[model samples]
Target: MLVRCSLLLPLLVWLAPAQGALERVDDFALLDQHGEFHQLSRYRHMRALAVMAYSADCPAMAEMAAGFEDLGHTLSDRDIAFLFIDTQGLDRGQLRGLELELPILDDGGRLVSAALEFGQAGEVALLFPERLSLFYQGAAGAGFEQTLDAVLAAEVTNSIADSIRAPLEAGCPLEFPVRETMLAEAPDYAGEVAPRIIENCGMCHRRGGVGPFALDSHLMLLGWSPMIREVLLNKRMPPMQVDPHIGHSRDAQYIAAEDLQVLVNWIDAGAPGPAGEADPLLALAEAPAPGWQLGEPDYIVQAPRQDIPPVGVLDYTYEETELGLGEEKWVRALQYLPGDQSVLHHLMSFVTGEGEDFWGAERRQENSTRRFLDGYAPGQDLLREFQPGTGVRIRPGEKLSMQFHYVTNGQSTSDATRIGLYFYDEPPEREIFTDAVSTRFLLPPNVPEFPLRASRRLERDAVLTGVRARMNFRGKKMKFAYQAPGEPLREIFSVPAYNYGWQPYYRLDEPIAIPAGATLHVIGAFDNSISNPNNPNPDAELRFGVESWEEMFTGYFTYHHAH
Candidate 1:
């Protein structure tokens, strides 16, 4: 059975439809089995988007898939994209076992299924991207083709295609345990829903946080439930989240499938909120502000004051603050205290020589090693303590260069961000440096995924402590992998769905060991197509550059040579 969510249905910026009665469906995105991103809204160029809930284990899957392929071939010339959604959780390799031509959207367990209320395999869904609504959803047969035909019939009217149909019960029943539990008893806001929000989302969605708005109270959740549901279904929130199955990163946390089910199902259940004495989310809101996570600093350096306007686009701000060090300093740990959390999007620091700036060696070469102190991104651990006996060495005459990126929050404010550096009582064992695997290429205009690769062979043994992906608006996803001499390749960290907005330096939960002669690799691609939401201009051919407007594919490898 498929559940319908009609009450308190929030509409997101609906323009009058050009054709057909507007049957509205909110926009969402998902990755196919091939690691390709597919967003429904971006398919406006297509006449129709054909999709079906697929289960490889289902008995009727073969016949239905064959018919779907036939129908796709029939509409080969027409602008129609046919895809399949995996009702059963299938990894890329398992999906490849099916050997299908069409991309199977690998829905992370049951998030998309719960969103569309799909409980059966082989259920069909035809969507009109222009109207942002479903044209048809049912079993794939005569009725399915008829619905699609009437949709593409070029002004021939049929009321059947416009109305929503209850999902047919012919195919195998896909079990959504979470949805079933919710149907039995709605998730209590205070007991289940709000606690999950406080755990996974509170850090970023609170007061003075980087999120667009605060999710402070029960009323707030009610207000933004639709947007929350949309982002959850599309895997947009929990910013800078990497693919959990591929690699492990201390900085990345993909909310558990059960947690996602609770939130989305709660939203589907009208995001009901009843007072239970104290709201957990409100507790997060009323809690003390972000203070020095690593306690007081031995030394503090402040960046220049930044004046942010109420609302508009802002460029990166660069400032250099001389440490004026009387003696050499070894920084074992550090943290950044942003003056205005709402506006200060990100700040990066580097230990450079007298006249150098934030670019360091990035501007001069495709690959180089330098003293990159650290970077600050939203929803990340503020305190960074280096590995035992390792420190970033700063000479007496060195200065700290910082790059500031601020986003306006509809309010005028000023920020004087400060860095707290914790030093070692005695000199550390080894100095830390960041090796970059970067490349320069001319990305073709309007290409969705322009493949790029960069690698460096290690001449000496080293331990990689952290990594950061540096790409501009068009950055899609970058992976950090290594192959030591004859050993098989191992992926340590990956920013699988890289977002330009949240650029966190991923600290590996387990540091990777690289012996001499090991080759490190950075494999990634840029999304210059219209599908990329952050792309400023998909029409322009782009090149590698230092500025944020241009594109750069550099994966920073923070490491220290093994003793």
Candidate 2:
């Protein structure tokens, strides 16, 4: 018989009406290892649900699975249900042989996985049927059995839970003590502050992070707390300078204001807290694994391996490959996995008919640029699935050209790059469009200031949709604005303080409306003197070129026109 836990009672009661936590999980369904459907409702009658988020091949997660199996055995007679969900699109076949005694579900879509707020590494949530509530949640450590026992003892009642029956009030007020606490009350360095740090700083500060060290454990945090506080107060940890009031959007690795405050208060209080229970949240199961998020790719095109000579600045290099598509092929999605993610800074992909010079086209003439299928930078996820019936097409005998910008790290290395292409036999519903803003201006040497501008007028009435600007460290400010044939101009996007390392493609929440025959303008300012820290040559005369040291003023726009 199922021994239901009181901790999950609230979630169960709330699950009935579908609101808040309950509502968030109602439509959740995921594909299991064998591509079978796994619905949350199927396990509704179980005493409790143990939800675990795992990555495909993370070493830390694989080791923790052994512990999870032990925990499952401990609760086997308690009628609890254990379900493992792979958060990063790893295939079941790859993970089939693992010695686990639970059903592992694949959350490739990330719908249910994200709804649970599952962090990157191991995270666990204990559900109670009595109040339909989450009794315990945290990363892996001790006290798991203690929390589980308490949740199981809580009695289940028929009264509707607040999350399910009651209308959610406006956001609840959060309270945190402002006064600093003494070191005696300080929480264990790992137990209290580790979770907060993992959520906020782990993404970029980890080994792969642009930072110098990884904060994967409590010892690392305690050692680096002083430096962490310095970086936070100085606003250097997160390297973007966007006016929050204007547009504060969510993305991977974004830290919330409240979370930031928690870090500040903890650091101010000398990071104090009582010894609570062990963290139930484990690191993402099977994390730090390698493989495609969407399983194996249908086709892989590897770039000719090239060695990076030790030392000196590296210029942009172009490598072209011939993908013999017998006929026009509709590309639904494409994934580019870097051979050496550490050294490869950025890559751009372009498609052209046989023997056409796509890059040369832009170099030879002003106001000249070719269409870009898609491009990727670090920390960027694959493009959202293309709209139904809409896909990028590559004609037969066309070449897939790639331009890679590499920064050497005093090591001799070669990269065999591969791009996975997913195609459809039929035409897509929507078409891909690219509009570029380019200039034909030159900059003189050692100039204190220079006005560089580029503008383009729409030949026909078209929507001015997504906008992204490109520039190097010498760039000061870039703004994209539009003026209708006879109307006042409005600025759509602006980067007042541009940083080359933090280049982002900013998409408007809503498409900006532009009238027919409107002119789109791109205004950019450059700082070529010693004042700019990123200037490669403060003394060299700067010219209009594609080189990073040289200046190029360009804005890319993606739009959809009425059929």
Candidate 1 C-alpha lDDT tens digits along 371-424: 989988877777888988999999998999888889988999999988999999
Q: Tally clashing residue pairs in candidate 1.
A: 0
Clashes found in each candidate (C-alpha, N, C closer than 3 A):
0, 41
- Global CA lDDT of candidate 2, please? 0.57
Provide TM-scores for the models.
0.88, 0.59
Write one digit per residue (lDDT tens) for candidate 2, span 1-563: 01222233333443243322321222244445533334443334455667666664566777666677678877887867666777655555654555456777755434345445455545665554323455345444454455566446644444333321211122222112222232224444455466777656554455543244666555566567767765543334565434332333232134444454456446645654335644322341112523576767656778878677656667778888898778888777778777765566667777876656546465655565455666655555544344455566788888888877666656677777678888876777656566777786666655535667787777765554456677776775677778886689777766554566555555455666566688888876776665454677757766667666667777777655434
lDDT of each: 0.80, 0.57
Supply the global lDDT for candidate 1.
Answer: 0.80
Report the number of the highest-TM-score candidate: 1
